[model samples]
Target chain A: MTIPVSITVNGRRYDREVEPRLLLVHFIRDVLGLTGTKVGCDTSQCGSCTILLDGVSAKACTCLAVQADGASVTTIEGLAGDSELHPLQESFWNKHGLQCGYCTPGMILASHELLRCNADPSAEEIRHGLEGNMCRCTGYQNIVRAVRDAAETMQGGTS
Target chain B: MFAPQFDYYRASSVAEAAALLEQHPDSKVLAGGHSLIPVLKLRLAAPSALIDIGRIDGIRGIREEAGRIVIGALTTHAEIAASATLQSGATALSEAAGMIGDPAVRNRGTIGGNVAHADPASDLPAVLRCLGAEFSIAGSSGTRTVDAADFFEGLMTTAVEEHEILTSISLPSGSGGQGSAYAKFSHPASRYAVIGAAASVAVADGVCSAASVALGGLVPAPVRAEAVEDALVGKALSAGAIADAARCVGDSLDDDEVLGDVYASAEYRSAVAHVWVGRALTAAAARCG
Candidate 1:
């Protein structure tokens, strides 16, 4: 059975008839062709498929398209504007936050949600916030530095 | 992995949900879809239909009523962790909620779904049992309440019948005076509790007047540490007394009930249950001010 769903992705609204079984991650990656949000572990453990569901960080792989119906979702692709990079992206780039880059998009989006909730989080809090998103290659030091730098940049300070 | 195909029904109200469940006996109620979706994707549970009750109105808030703190079933872990009222009155529950998975999982996982899922490794059930909470269930017949002790049946089983929906969980309002804490040793990878101990102690004039301890991950379901509770009550809230009580944390359980796996042997889980209960009780007692 297919369910009709209208979801606003990033800023644009996309209405589609999705099978009841189609996961939100697949809907965004396969159907919508927004591949910025990588699927790391298809299981719920890895947060590479993390996205902002209605402005809250959630695992897209664990959510169904039907469950996200009428909801607003923000993915890694939504972080940047037309020309400029989002503060998180810029800070990550400046700080060399990624090694393999597979976990960068998810790390950036997860950090975005973290900074939104807590604009000035301590190192421990940032680590706690990004617990869901795993980076196998970066060893997390640079990612933590990137998040700290992003927090500083987002708060009107230079890193 | 993708979820198996199933008919989806969005119920506008609890009655509608119950009716839908009645009509489709093989239907599963989808709340946040954090737990259900994963199971569905694994093809472990392929219900014929899904009754989506994620947007139900009355089952989604934290409020005080009749000297009891009532948390709607649909309240997500994020909501519970962020609830100031819960933090003040039910600190153990709030702390436990915060410890489940991570921010992303907490944002999407609901208390009702967690309690109903009854995963032995889940953190909330043990904390709820320690808090002496009660569940308000909605079914076709009528609404009924069940104590947390009776609500859990066995591995991934709950007292909630197939047709019933867990509407809300209520705890006594004066839970703050009875300070509580949840000490958990979880698996590093999945963050599921390897052994968690939730402790609550009502201190009167530096004496432990009442005590309750519940354990998860050491058994098939969350079990109350009755022996630990018995050892602590009416004793001085001292390190010695707590140490004595901690020894009885899981003493009542049979060896077969203490599960063993590659992560933790039954003996290891049993031993840590004592240590964790001790730490949780010490922390809880220290907060009783």
Candidate 2:
């Protein structure tokens, strides 16, 4: 059976009929064609499918498309504004937070949540907050640095 | 790694959820989808339908009411962790909730689903048992309340039947001279507990008046460390006294009941239980008065 779902992504609402068993991550990637959100681990353990569901960070791989009906989703594609990069993206780029870059989108989005809740987080707090997302490359030192830099930049401090 | 084909029904209210449960005998109530989704993906459980109650309105939040902390069913682990009332009153629960499966998992995993699924390694079951929490279950007929002692039956088992929906959980709010803590030896990769201990200590005039200690993760169900509790009830909660009491944790655990996996052997987990229990009691004692 298929269910009708209307999810607003990046402030644009898209209505579709998805198979009841189809995952929200698949719908965002396949149906919506927003491939910035990668599926890593497919299980909820890896946060590569992390997205903002109703302004809160959640694992999209764990959520079914039907479950996301009427919800507002913000994927990595939604991070930038017009031509400028989101402060998190800019910080990641400037800090060389990615070597393989597979975990960057989810890392950035999860960091965005941490910064949204906490305007200025310490290095340890950033590492702890981004524990959900995993990066096989960079050994997480630069990821921590990137999130720290993003927090500073987002908080009106020069980074 | 995808959930098998199953019909999805979004329930509007608790009453409707209960009705759906009655109608779809093979259906599972989907809350935050933390526990259930993983189970579904692993093909461990394939229900005919998934009644998505994640969006139910009135069944999510923590409320301080009449010396009790009442937590609605759909309250996420992150919500419980961030609950200022729970933080101040029910320290063990909030602390344990905060430590479950990192940040993103906590954001979406609900306490009700955690308890209902009753994963042996889950954190809340032990903490709830330590706090003497009560569970409210709604059925087609009416709602019934079950104490924490009676709620968890065994591994992956709970008192919630097929026709019932867990609605809320309640426990006494923290008071002066009383405190709680949860200590766990977590597996590195998955972060699931190897041995989780939750302790609640009540002290009066520099002496321990009461104590409730429970352990999970390595056992099939939350086992009460009654001997540990008895030893502490009349002691001064001294380091030596706490250590002595922590040793009694072995009395409550049977050799046959301990769980062994690739990460830790049964003997290893049994050996670690006393350590984590002692740590939990020490932390709880420090927080007490």
lDDT of every predicted structure (CA atoms): 0.90, 0.91
Ten-residue segment with the worst summed lDDT in candidate 1 chain B?
Answer: B171-180
TM per model? 0.98, 0.99
lDDT (10s digit) by residue, model 2, range B1-289? 7778898888898889999988999999999898998899899999999988887888899998898999999999999999999988999999999999978888889999999998888899999999999999998899999999999999999999998999999999999999999998988878888899999999998899999999999888898999899988988988999999999988899999999998899999988788899999999999987
lDDT of 1 by residue, B66-108 (tens): 9889999999999999999988888899999999999989998
Error of 1 at B90 (Å): 0.8
Clashing pairs in 1: none
Q: For candidate 1, give the DockQ.
A: 0.88
Residue runs of model 2 more than 4 Å from their true location after superposition: none
Residue B207 in model 2: shift from native, Å?
Answer: 0.6
TM-score of 1: 0.98
Clashes of each: 0, 0
What does candidate 2 score on TM? 0.99
